[model samples]
Each structure stands twice: as C-alpha cells, then as structure tokens.
Target: MSDDLPTISFDEALPITAHVDQLRQALHDHQVLVVAGETGSGKTTQLPKICLLAGREHIGHTQPRRIAARSLAARIAEELGEPLGQTVGFQVRFARKHSEATRVTVMTDGILLAQIAHDRQLRRYDTLIIDEAHERSLNIDFLLGYLKQLLPRRPDLKVIITSATIDTARFAEHFDDAPVVEVSGRGYPVELWYRPVTDGDHLDAICTAITELGTRDGDILVFCSGEREIRDATDAIRAMDLRFTEVLPLYARLSAAEQHRVFTSHTGRRIVLATNVAETSLTVPGIRYVIDPGFARISRYSARTKVQRLPIEPISQASANQRAGRCGRLGPGICVRLYSEEDFTSRPEFTQPEILRTNLASVILQMADAGLGSISDFPFVEPPDTGQVTDGVRLLNELGAIHDGGRRDAVRLTQIGRRLARLPVDPRLGRMLLESDRLGCLRQVLPIVAGIAIPDVRERPAEHEAAADALHRRFWAPLGDDAEASADGSDIAALLRLWDYLRDQRRQLSGNGFRRRCRAEYLNFLRVREWQDLHSQLKQACTELGMHRNDAPADLAAIHTAVLAGLLSHIGLRDP
Candidate 1:
C-alpha cells in the first residue's frame, strides 16, 4: 500500500509539519478531532491526504462551495499525479463524478448532509473531513453538532473539522474537549492602511484606492458586500484614471469563465472587485493588493417581521483579517482598509454563526430529515434564540414541508419536502419547481426559478440599459400573473440572448465595454452557468416525479404560491 501511494512535495515549514502530524495522529488515536488554521494555510488541500496515507482508506472532505470543492480536488489530484475523478473525486448538488475506488471525495457541505440523511452512519468513508468550519454555514454547523452525537455511536468514524480563523475553544468545548490543533499560515507581511471614509464614498474610495494601487506591480483584490457593490466598484474602477489596468469583476454571479479570469494572471495589472465569496473559500493566485470596504452583506432573520433581509453590515474582525490576508498569499503586500482603525477594533471577533442570521426553515427541514430531533435540543457552539427556533418550526409548518405534532414532538419531512430538498435550489424555489412540474410549466417556471436563485446573470452594457430592459420585457409575458408565458417569453431565451450578445461583443469590443455590459446589468456570467445547472437539476426532478413535457398552460398561480410558500418570510406585501 505504501509503495502504491503517490509521493508529493509540500513546503516543509514548522507549522505545516506540526499540523500534518497532528492530523495524522488524530486519525490514529481518537475517532474525532478539529483542526483550526487560518486562510493561506495548506490544511484545506494537504490534511486529508495525510489522513488517507496514515489510515490506508478513502477520505471524504466537505467544502462550502462547489467551485472550491472541484478546484481543490483537481489541484490535489494533479499534485498526486492522478487523473481527475480517479484518485480524487468531487460531488456538488447537481454534478458528481466519483468512483468506488476513489481515495478521496471532496464535496459541498450540503451534499455531505444529504448523504448523511441517506446513510446515517456514513459507513462508506473511513474518515470525514469538514473544511471551512469557521464559515459556520447552516449545513456545517448542523453536521458538526450531529456528528458529535454520532461519534460515540459509530466509534469507527473519524471526523476532522478544518477552519480558517474561528474561535476554536468554542468548537473544542462543543466537541466535548476534542483536542484542538493549530497550524500557522504561509501569509506574508501585509502593510495595513486605514483610509477615512465619508458617508457615501464607499464606491469612490475603493475605486480611488484601486487606481492608486494599479500604478504599482501585481493584481488588486477589492472586497465589497455583495454583487451590487462589486458591479458598482468595478464600474467606478474602470471609469477611474487607471487606463492601464484591466478590470475584472468577480462574484458568485459571474459566469465560471469570468470568475476564472480573476484567478488567471495577465501581463498588465489586473483589478478584481469581488464579494465576500473571495474572503475564505477562494485563493486568487497572484493578488498582491487588497481594498477592503469594511462591509459585507449578511442574510439576517428578522424575528419581528419574520423575514429574511440581506443587510449590509460591518464585517467581523475574523472576516476582515481573512480579507487582508488575501494580499499576502504570494508575497509581501498592502491592504488598504476603507474604514478607520477604530472601526476594526470595535468589530466582532468572528461572524455571527449562520444559525443566528439565516431563516432557519431549510435548516429545520434538514435537521428533521437528518433525524436530529427538535433543533432546540441539538448541541450548537452557540445555541440560537428560542424565538428563532420557534420561527423556523412555524415557517416549516406553514410551508407544509414538515408535519408538526406528536408526543415525541418530532418533525418529519413530507414527500413534497423530500422532493424540495433534492432540487438544488432554495426550498421556496424548489417548491415552485415541483409545483410547476405538476402544472406542466417546468420549461417556463424552471428558468424563472433559476433566475431568482441566481441574481448575478442579468448582463447589460452600461449604455445599453434600455436594450437590456427591452430584452427583459420581451420575456415578461404581458399576460396576467396567473397566465403562463410562452417558451419564447421564458427566462431561458433571455439568458441565451444575453449570452449570445456577450459572445458577440467579446469579439467586437476593444475597451471594457463587455465588462461594462455585465456590470450594468448586474450579471455574472458564471452565475448564469450555475443557473443553467440548476435549471437542469429541476428538470431532472420533474422527470423523477414522472411529470411529462406538455404544451398545456401551467397553473402559474399555484407555482407562484408554492414559491411564496417557502419565501413567505421574505415576502413584502404591497399596500392595497
């Protein structure tokens, strides 16, 4: 077995060596452990294989994002001299290319949760590695809490929690004093400069800083709160006096090709304006300068309104540190913070865990699906407010996703709920997709659902907003809300038209006109691809439900209501 093992070289720094040994020993000793390391540390890529070698069995690693899972798997495979999906495989919500013989499988945390729902024991893997635990995503937190209860029952299961910069003491306490191992990162010294900001100068200040940095060597990474800011900053940067810099805007919305450009190196200076997506999961290879706007868009659950709001808030110190560390990955760098040092000192140490922030409907559904009884009793590093838990159960009950009653007080998923969970979309959109299928509007409803789930795909030229609006209206069926639009009026046609226009313009434009179109329309080409994948998945769900394609008018009202079912908390009633 040792002879068959592939040999690979890594930086032999003290921290890397120590962390590798700790991970190796953890698998050797206890069946569960948590490894805490900052971003730019090699743990994300390196630790799993160390366990694979030490234990002589396949290792399963979970990531928060599909792109990160696939990219990291490919990089690890390359280092191990194995072809993609051979020794290393990856599985996301809609895509999977793994084999029984695969030594390591890297997948999204949601996928892992789905697997656990199917197989409570996770008997297939000898070791389970949960990466990016600090993100504290709904799935990650649930997995951690669930697995803690699972460890004693399945002593054979070895679990590893890998995080960037999290409060490990809390995690250790949650795991009942699971030994905590720390690893030093490879980040270089980054000069920090806090620039004072006026009330509305967020975009201007970031652009100005990027323009100043563009004159120097290396690429620039500007962090913003969301897609809107990313687009605004990208446009502002291009409009600035940095004619020499090639501006590339990156976010979850960009098409895979566009997002990939941020990672690609260019001859001239490249400026990447992105959202929080870049902070931890992704490592842009050549970024040497970082512009942090000090704000990030966080999805919050409003108990008062019982709604989910994507409000911009000051980033936690951990996130700020992660953003700054991006600059120092390759070499010495500079991080120009948009806020004063006073703001930094006052920031929260880490982000509020996802349990506290997000509408917990899906989380409750997931917990119910996982047979984790009553989320209130589940062990969390930081238990959510009872009001939030009550809201989650109530929301799930209203959506008809869970049956709520009994002496056990257990929540169980309905048949529709199971279908909803499998749709690779928000529970609300999943309900809409299922209902649309039943209504024979899969073709029409699927694309719209995809569009709503993916907001960064509507591309338009800065000057051609009128044209983009025209195209959008072309797909906007004038028929009543209850009427189904023709296939030509569907969102698929709109996306195809936009994609065709982008391809044509890419061939014709010399300046940043193509990017300007993307920015103006709030589109990310990569997000369109993600939407397409989502559309395909919904279609598969339709087929699984035995719904056939037909020309019949879909129950548009029912589909809308189904979407509203899961999104009831997010709904805004208009004055009648």
Candidate 2:
C-alpha cells in the first residue's frame, strides 16, 4: 500500500469482498461501473472503501433516505477505525456532519441534486456512487441522466451505480453498456412459505404468521405498507400477548431516539414492523424471519386528473425479493409471504420508475434551471410518457416558472421559476412563497408552506384516535366561530393556529417541557421541530434571495389569495 493511501479493512464475511479486485480493475477500466449485489451483500457499506483503494479521493455517495446515509456513514467510519465526521461523514436536510479531513461523504440523493444547482460540474467529488439505483426514485433518475450527460465533459470523474440484481442491465445500458460486476449474497438459504390471506384481513394474516413462527429462535421483521399499518400490526401482535417479545415500529417519520431502538441490543426477541423503507433503503440487523404482506404505498401522479396520490399497491417481484433477502443476513431464515406464489410470479418484474409515475413539474423546473433542454429531450434512463411531460411543462407554466420560447421545443425558466428552483420546497409551495412576497404576507405563509412540505406534525396514534382528534380540534377555526380567526374555511387556518400555539408553548416551556406537551397533545415532537427547522431554512433562503416577510398584522384574505395562486388546479366548482 502507498504511504498516502488510507489503511482500510474489509470484513471477509461480507460477500462483496470476494470481488474487490474485479471492482478495482473495472474502476481502472471504465468511467462508470454497475454493481448488481443483492440485499445483505454488504455493498452499501463497503463500496466507498473500494473506491478509496482504487485511488479515488473525496467520494460522494448517495442513499435514498437520511437515516440510511447517517447510519451507513457511522458504520463505514467505524470499519475504517476512525470517528464519524472524520474520514466518513453524512449530510441530510438540516443536518451535516463533515469536516475538512472527511474523504467519504454520504448524503441523500436529493442533497446531491440540490448541490448540482450550485456546483454544476460537481467538482467536489472524484468518485460518485449512486446507491440503490433500482429504487429508481425521481432524484436517482435525474442524477443518472444528468451524470450520463456530464461524463463526457468530466472524463476524470468516476461513477459507480449500485443496485440489487433487478434491472441492472438497464442501468448498464444507460451508461453506454458499462461493465457490470455481480456480487453474490451471503449464501444463506432463505425458505419462502406462501401464506395467502383467506380472511381478507392482512393484520390477521400477520398475526397468524407470527403465531406459526412462534417456535422460531430469531427476531421477526414484518413489512407493512406505511406507518398506519405498522401501528396496527404492532397492536395486533401485542394483542397476541406473546411473552419475552418486544414489538417495535420503524419508519421515516420516526424520531432519531425512537429509531435507535431497532439498532440497539435488547434481551428478548423483537418483532419489527416497518414500511418499505426497510426493504432496500434501510437494513435492520438480527432479522431471521420476514413476514412480507406484499403491499407498499406507491406514489403515482395522474396527468389527466392532475392529482398526486399515494395508494397501497402490490409490490413488484424485485421488491418482494429484496424484502425476503433481509432475513438471510444473519443465518438460514424463513420468509412468510402473505400472498400466493402465483401472484408474485404474475406481478411486474420491477416497480415503475418514479419519473414515469410522478408529477414531473419539479423535475422540469430542475432541468430547466440546470439549462438542460426540454423534458422530452432529456436522456432519462427510461423516458417518461410524452403526455406526462406535457403536463409537467403545463404545471410549470401555470406556476409562472417557465415561459414558452418562439420555438415549441425551447423551454425556458422565468425569473419566478429560477427563484422557485432555488427554494427547496415543491413548485406549488414555492409559488405560494412568491405570491406571499407579492401580498406582503411571507411571514404568515412561510410556516404554512413548510408544514405542507413535511409529514403532518399532529400524530393520531391508533389507540388514541379519538383523544388526538379532540385535541386537534382545539386548533380548528370553525365557521362563524371567530370572524378574525377563521381563514375563510381554509385548512391553512388550522395550521397557522397550531403553529402559533406551538410557538407560544416553545417560548414559555423548557425544551423537555415542550416535548412533553407535544406528546400530551398528540403531536410528533420531532416533526414539529422539523417544521420549525424547515421554516428557518426557508426564511434563510428568502433572506439570501432578498425576499422579506411583512411586519403588518396577519391578513387571512391575502393569505388565502397567496395560497390559491399555487393551488388553482385544486379548486372545484360546487353545483347547487
């Protein structure tokens, strides 16, 4: 090893190590290399070290979720025998932990996309690893397409795309038939037992499966579609009254302190109920049995209806396989699928790329701001439907983000669009901000926009739905109740009331007291804090852009007008 090279060690137990030399040689041979490693292949944690060994410095790696980036950074730094934020660090929204000495910086793919707006050439990184590309998120697809265009300009930059065995060929083909290195998993045999739900209740099926696996000697991992399902599953399993077992819930909305329970060592076996966030984005340890319900909340945007919806849909075969692979990590394991094998075989080979199903308005804004040509002409790995592209452009036009050039193919960003692109919120919310600036009510709109951009701060636990609802109603401004307080029957009024209440509470109460009060009020303290953080971030972005909030008293009418500018499409006429 050269004296300047960082001394790094790899766990021989991990299957990815077997192909280290091949990966190194491929890096030397090509600008882009695709690695098709299954879940538990240890590719996520070890790939950065391989890049370092290949003589690449200052690597930028992206994970789909903030938790994954932070956890993986900690794990990699520990493996390198250094403290976190020293050799390996991570940056997520509102959180950063990197120093001047950091060589490997892991961040969410969205963070990388945001960086592209400022650092067009990505001069900070010599090697970029797009991890879990098979997820095919909007940010990932945009990055893939952008990198494809950027590779020729920056021949010195090396790119590595890591994904499971699913759709690796398409990724390779996207990069001009880049060489692919396949790494086998840990080789633990995972037995799949199909347990289709005959009772029409998945919770019952999950409980029955848990009862059947009661004899099993390892921790159980149940895959639910969302937080609501997780909560229901946790209650269902608890109702079973299994002894010596702890039930835990995992999801993206969870606070860091709550998420830590899954990683910490405990005495009894645990039943971890989680969303698809666990499928590939996060890897929970000590999972020897997986109960997959074969359903997840998939985001889809309807161009005709102009609505964005998250519906519970069947998981593709690739996602099912990823869930099953989670258990085989520790040892020989079993996966009890709550759907028929024939159903699995009949499902799609892969989930639809988010680019195809999602609203492309934000994406179009991003591309336009990057000076990329029309959305139709951008080199997406899988080109989106032309109608969807038109809808995106139309939405941008509606928001005054883009203006048509004399030529039909020429799509240009307006000043409003450039400002919208600079703010990290949705284009609709960004439009609301701009309108607020015009209405002289940015102070009132900033928090509402940030609140809409995040998961709701009010949490209704399954067990205390009524209590939560009643407490939440305290913030509601009903019709004819208070002339000054009501926001013309707009839900934004409720949000403002809640924000005001929280702000008042925060001022008077200590940190711990505020958190306790939030809990008593059935509000997610972390989410409330996140709301505040985002508001602060938006405030700072506005300041930098020279947009100022008003000092006048709150005006519900002007606020409603400002909010309506962004939601014109959502308004409907009622027939009398």
What lDDT does model 2 reach?
0.84
lDDT at 486 for candidate 1? 45
Clashes found in each candidate (C-alpha, N, C closer than 3 A): 12, 0
lDDT (0-100) at residue 380 of candidate 1?
Answer: 76
Per-residue alpha-carbon lDDT of candidate 1 for residues 1-576, written as tens digits (9 for 90 to 100): 456567755666525665666567766887667787777777887886787668547688998887688778877888788887877889886677777668889999888787876788888887889988889888888888888878888877788888765677777778778887778666689999899787445766886676566477888888876665566567677777576678887665456566666656578778887777788887777789999988875656555544444445789998998899889877899999998999899988888888777667666766777676777788877777776567666766666787755212577888887666554445666666666666666666666665565444655768777877655554345322322434445444454444445556657963346555655555554354445555665567677666665677555565465455556667787799
Backbone clashes (count) for model 1: 12
TM-score, cand. 1: 0.74
Candidate 1's C-alpha runs over 4 A off are 13-15, 199-201, 239-244, 253-261, 264-266, 385-391, 404-408, 419-576
Q: How would you encode candidate 2's per-residue C-alpha lDDT over 454-490 as one tens digit per residue?
A: 6688988899999998788766674336544653546
Question: lDDT of model 2 at residue 298?
Answer: 73
The global C-alpha lDDT for each of the candidates, from Candidate 1 onward, is 0.71, 0.84
Would you estimate the TM-scores of all the predictions? 0.74, 0.75
